[model samples]
Target: MSGSDSAAATSRYSAFLFDMDGTILNSIAAAERIWGVWALRHGLDVASFLPTIHGARAVDTVARLALPGVDPEQEAIGITLAEIADVEGIVEISGAADFLRSLPADKWAVVTSAPRDLAARRMKAAGIPVPAVLVTAEDVAAGKPHPDGYLLAASKLNVDARDCLVFEDAAVGIAAGEAAGATVMVVTATHFHPLASPHPSINSYETMFTEIDSDGLMLLQERGA
Candidate 1:
């Protein structure tokens, strides 16, 4: 849900947790280009695969779509390498860099489904600052929707899960954030349709404002209010 009142009501999150790919980085085109190639190699339908691919790890996605003989780990690694090299379409999500800059770096972290190396590469490619505490696919036994990554990120930031706020663009990531006991805010760029979830959402960080007041961290609407 979004509007002047909702944005005005959003304030005082202890810490910020962000999903990388669709939330902070606009890597959908790059992802589709690489995953599409891998899908064809395995004879999987791209149309059916794209919907389930976002916010999921390569290994998990490979396991879900791989043919009988396909080695999930090997295919996952291959796809990771391809994505690292295919940086053509990778770019920072609008207002991402500026929003992050407004926060205390120690109070925010990136929780991504991408592996450590790939996540780093994408952040660098998009000119987004890499967080000191990054929870990647390899850092967790499970990925989004399980809350492991988000929990780990909060722990690493030395913040309580309930005190955290998460920004995400996929249903799985949203589930993870909520499961982690944080308020989840949906980003509408990657998610084309209206969000049906209960959480508040913003189309971009451009519409939001961050301020550190005596009460702690507060996020407000730049214009909606």
Candidate 2:
């Protein structure tokens, strides 16, 4: 969806939840920084990890990089920390800061896989302000691709899952939103040319934003009046 599409989507709901990393923040530099270091350390295939772990959690990514008996968790964390340390290059996506600032604080929140410190670091590096409610990996027993994180964001917003909409960068995130019963908006953080994506989603900014009921905006949109 284009910027106009975001205006349209926002007019349709009461609450909005955003994903960090590829969705609203550009941390590819930070990620690549970390992964490349890990790849060098383990002599593992960096190319394979790139295609596989974009939206994946650190623990999961690490566990998947087994090299004929190499442990995944042990490997994934080493990469994640290195990535976290060199986050000087993180930046917010175009229009992300503007859109976030336009919404009411109470109506929006962030749900991300980053542990709190890393999330803060990336947000700072990107010049994106942290929201009132940020659901991190520490907050959930399960992470993305699991409905736990999305559901947690909705709960914090004090809205029903049906009333919440989510913006995401990965298939796992889209799946998680669908499971949570929130509308999912997909972005190109995971891949470029979002319009050509085989996945179905809302908005071209590739965002799913909702009004916080200010001036009855959300309600008005819902009634289609």
Candidate 3:
């Protein structure tokens, strides 16, 4: 579903919603280092468990595992603290900063499964600007795979969810966006392998560009178009 393969190449939306970690920046190395250590400590297979942790809140991911003697909330706090302390290897997705900068600031929001502090830190570390409207894990009663975050972001932007476009990189986040009634665009900048999706996708923001019409609607399209 690369940009060139779909009608999304010329799609226009009133606003854009973006996921934080995998969508706007590459935090896989830092995340895996911390989560991998925690997984080993819990007697879980690092390789098998790491993939499940992305695109959702730590508490939700931990609770879903239902590990014996583990308090999901407490463990999530510990993990967040560790993540906040380690921003090493975090970098912006190619052209992410420039692409975001090109958009009207009020026309976009960042919806992330990461807690507020961690999201801010990671965005800062990657040199990505923090959006004025950010819906973090704590802001919503539920994380991705639920529409709360994206819906809230749309609400805060004073736009209809259906009129917004969501940019995401994980299944749960994509589900959340769709649940919010937004068209989704997948970002595979951090993916180790190709992703299969019906939604339009881009390997990096470098492949796309933004335009604002006279009516102020934002258009997302392939670079040369």
Candidate 4:
């Protein structure tokens, strides 16, 4: 194996809960398909709009697509529906399925910004099982950056928030996990700048992460011991 590949395989962690989009699945293709439609309908250039939508929830996605005349909440539903229908480009995250299957299911679950329908469609398209506990947009009164979703996931797992480890690709999701009293792990899907919006920059486990796996995902962090 190559030097870089060697370092990746040796990475380790204790317990892990992975995020679906961007983190464990490459959803840009399907997301782009839906967002592109939003951009065109709003007269905005698709390229310019894609970056801003990376970490946003459906309400945020819809709000941005709404522009001035449209109601953001109403438009978010359309975007959500369009996304569910546009499952053409959805795929599992890099090394995500293998890593997930390699680990025990009771120790992990998926926490997503996408609503139930969209999450189901994408998971099916990506050939990944629907996580035992799905904390979708419908589950949380507020999405990421609010901590509700992460908190609920940990609670459902019967694990203390501080004992849970979260694998998130978005700054908001990371913030949510951290805020919910859990250890937050940042998967380097994009440059740090996007995540630079918040979250303390972490290089080691210290008080932040118990340990991160080869893929930058935290594992075994939620152990009760």
Q: Give the candidate number with the greatest lDDT.
A: 3
Candidate 2: worst-modelled 10 consecutive residues by lDDT: 216-225
Ranking by lDDT: 3, 1, 2, 4
Q: Report how far off residue 68 is in candidate 3 (Å).
A: 1.5
Question: Residue 102 error for model 4, in Å?
Answer: 2.9
Task: Write model 2 residue lDDT over 166-208, tens digit each, in one string.
Answer: 7787877777887898766676644655544334343234243
lDDT tens string, model 3, 35-144? 99999999998889999999999999999999999999999999999999999999999989998998888999999999999999999999999898999999999888
> What global local distance difference test value does model 1 have?
0.84
Better of 3 and 4 by lDDT: 3
Candidate 1 local lDDT, residue 20: 97
Sort order, TM-score high to low: 3, 1, 2, 4
lDDT of 4 by residue, 56-129 (tens): 58786666454777887887888888888788867765545655665556667788988889889988898877
Across residues 89-110, which tens digit of lDDT does each residue of candidate 1 receive? 7888888888887778888999
* Residue 113's lDDT in candidate 4: 86
Candidate 4, poorest ten consecutive residues by summed lDDT: 1-10
TM-score of 4: 0.75
List residue ranges in candidate 1 displaced over 4 A: 1-8
Which parts of model 3 have CA positions greater than 4 angstroms off?
Answer: 1-5
TM-score per prediction, in order, is: 0.93, 0.81, 0.96, 0.75
C-alpha lDDT values of all predictions: 0.84, 0.71, 0.91, 0.67
